[model samples]
Target: MKKSYSIEEINSYLNGELIGTTTHLIEGPEQLQAAKSHHISFIGSIKYAKYWAASKACAAIVNDNLTMEPIDNKAIIKVKNADLAMAKVLELFNPPAPEFTIDIHPTAVIHDTAIIGKGCKIGANCYVGKDVELGDNVILYPNVCVFDETVIGENTVVWSGTVIRERCIIGSHCIFHTNVSIGADGFGYRPSEDGRGLVKIPQIGNVIIGHYVEIGANSCVDRAKFSSTIIGDGCKIDNLVQIAHNSVMGRFCIMAGHSGLAGSVTLGDGVIIGGSASIKDHTTIHSGATVGAGSGVVGDVEAGKTVLGYPAQDARDMLKQWVAMRQFMKKQ
Candidate 1:
């Protein structure tokens, strides 16, 4: 069932400056063009301001700087940032959390030496290897596998089909989405003595993931050949990302979908990697660096630089080259 809130109620929730009357009810949030008399809309930027006058919404969330002509049937709630205010409003209308009863399912196979923490929910077909320690409120969804000696902190949630390999350390409030594989073998090999084939170099190190980190579905973080592969606090890794062995990412790094880092790559704090970008081995990307989508990074990137293209040069330089190429093609 959809919940309805009055204009005054929403204003109180978002601490917004209420404009016009507050008698109408808001069923939910919608875009300006799609909103109806019972729905609320938002205008985050001036680009969408033109639609405000024609919107049929009962109320609209707008930034404090926005100025629109008053409409009789509509109310305006002004906030510091319309986008942030919209996030709060969306939470209010979000569905209730799913309930999980029977903390440990009967079908779960847990080793006798494993320590299950308080308020944990281990679902059906899940496997907890020997000597594993799961902290309080940890929830493992169905078919999840936690290998031997792995330690997971409080309130961490591992979704179905995910695997945490041996001796990994995952911090509190971390989320591992479906099919994520942590601490897999690194792609390391040695030339064989006979020179016929390559010899597999054993991956002896594990992964260390910090608090509030969320790894998206189907991503893989390889175990290091030595020492740990570390993912820093609050990092958000998108789906299908590959974090190679011995790689260390500083706090709050954002890696978009299909982006990857080769072995021993280092990323400083707040680095942003766009979709499908790849950084070569032993490279360092400094803090606040922005790597554009589909870029191929082969060397170290300086702090606060925005790089683009195959060789990943300065974004402005790459744009100029592209423009020159286009002009030359036109001449032909």
Candidate 2:
């Protein structure tokens, strides 16, 4: 059920200064164009503020830096950062997650040698293979599979149809969305001795994921050829992303949807990969580097640099090149 809060209560929750008065109750946050009279919205920029006069939102969280003439009837809560404040408001109205039974379901299959910790909830049709160790309060949804010798830490939740392959080590407070695949064999092939066919190199390594990692649906983390494919703490991988074999992702890295890292690619802390970006094999992206959407990175990126274009280069250089090309085209 949806909950409602008075304008004053919402203001207090945000710790923002209330600019105007409203008796209305805010049930949820909505987009400015789609907001109803009972909903709240945010104005984070001048582009969005233009829609405020046409919006029906009962209250709005406005950026403190933006100057807005007070409307007659609507309530305005001014905050330092409107976007961040709206995230809190959304959490306030967020509903509870779907409840699974507290214990292991009868329909699930568990190997006798598997060690399941206290308060672990294994849903129907799930399979726990030999020597698997699951920590306390781990929740495995239906149809999930854990291969032999895998270890998952406490308070991890894996949604339906996810698979954790052999010997993978997953840390605490991790969330894997539906259809995620962890520790799949790396793409390693070489010409056979006969020189007629490709020979598959054995992928003997496991994946090591640190705490507080969240992998979105359909993403895959491939196992290494020898050591480990590592995902550091607080990494967030979006849907359809791929982390290839031996790739090392540092702490708090964010990979957007469809972004991929080729084999042996290394990323330093706080690297942000935009949607559909592809990093070439053996390339290193240093700390705080940003890869623009649709860019193809074929080489190393230095720290704190933003790269763009197909063969990704510094963002400013790419922009200047585009401007030069445009000017040359006019001479044709």
Candidate 3:
């Protein structure tokens, strides 16, 4: 449960208007519907001002331009940007990061040929294969198995049960959560006389994850065929995401939860793929293209385009189609 804060106190905190002990409390706007006497909610637009009186929330954070009659029991905090104020509230409730302790677990089996750097901590039941190189202060949690010839950079952290397959090259400050699989074989099969014959082609290449890349829990990145499966610097991949063979993503891209990209797809810098987006193979998506949630991209996407819906039309076309579908349903 979240700690409570009065609306007047929240407004004071957001506007830097008051220096009181109440700024330490944390609450989200959605919680205001169920919040007790001390909970805080936000009213960013005049459109949502109608909900103000109906909300059980203790306080309302509103934009400066909204002119609404004060609720009988609710307090109001006025701010220039309510969205940024939400970020500040989240920061106050953020969890602390784990620190690197200089101790390797005795249950881990490290090859004598491997080079482990100073202050690195290898966890229990872990396997460090031959010729593996770990940089300074790397932390591998319990049950992590890194195959031969893998290289992890300084200050990187691999969580429990993560498997780094053979010949993987990862950069500094990368974080791999539990059960993340790197360098796994890509989907390659040729249909046969017998019900689509399942033939397997070996993934001969490795995965190259650049600096500050974060792969969430249960995410699997397939190895390449001839080159590396490259994730550029500062790319953040959400949980259960699948990145197939030879996929090259440029810097600072965000792949939301459950999104899957087929083999050989190339994404330019800063592309944003929303939740559950599916991009077919061999397609190129230019920089700054925003693929909306549940979009199915079957072809190349131009730069600066926001595509949505199945087959992924332009944003305008997608909206028009939605309007038509709703009208057709009414007629029926």
Which has the greatest TM-score?
2
Candidate 3 clash pair list? 7-59, 192-197
Compared with the true structure, what per-residue lDDT tens digits does model 1 show for residues 199-254?
Answer: 99999999999999999999999999999999999999999999999999999999
After superposing candidate 1 on the true structure, give the runs of residues whose Cα lies further than 4 Å from its correct spot.
none
Which lDDT values do the candidates have, in the order given?
Answer: 0.95, 0.95, 0.84
Q: Clashes in model 1: which pairs?
A: none
Q: What lDDT tens digits, residue by residue, belong to model 2 across residues 83-187?
A: 999999999999987787647889999999999999999999999999999999999999999999999999999999999999999999999999999999999
lDDT of 1 at 320: 100
Model 3: residues >4 Å from true position, as ranges? Answer: 1-30, 36-85, 97-102, 191-197
RMSD of each: 1.8, 1.2, 4.0
Evaluation by TM-score, superior candidate among 2 and 3: 2
> Distance (Å) between predicted and true CA of 262, model 2?
0.4
TM-score of each: 0.94, 0.97, 0.81
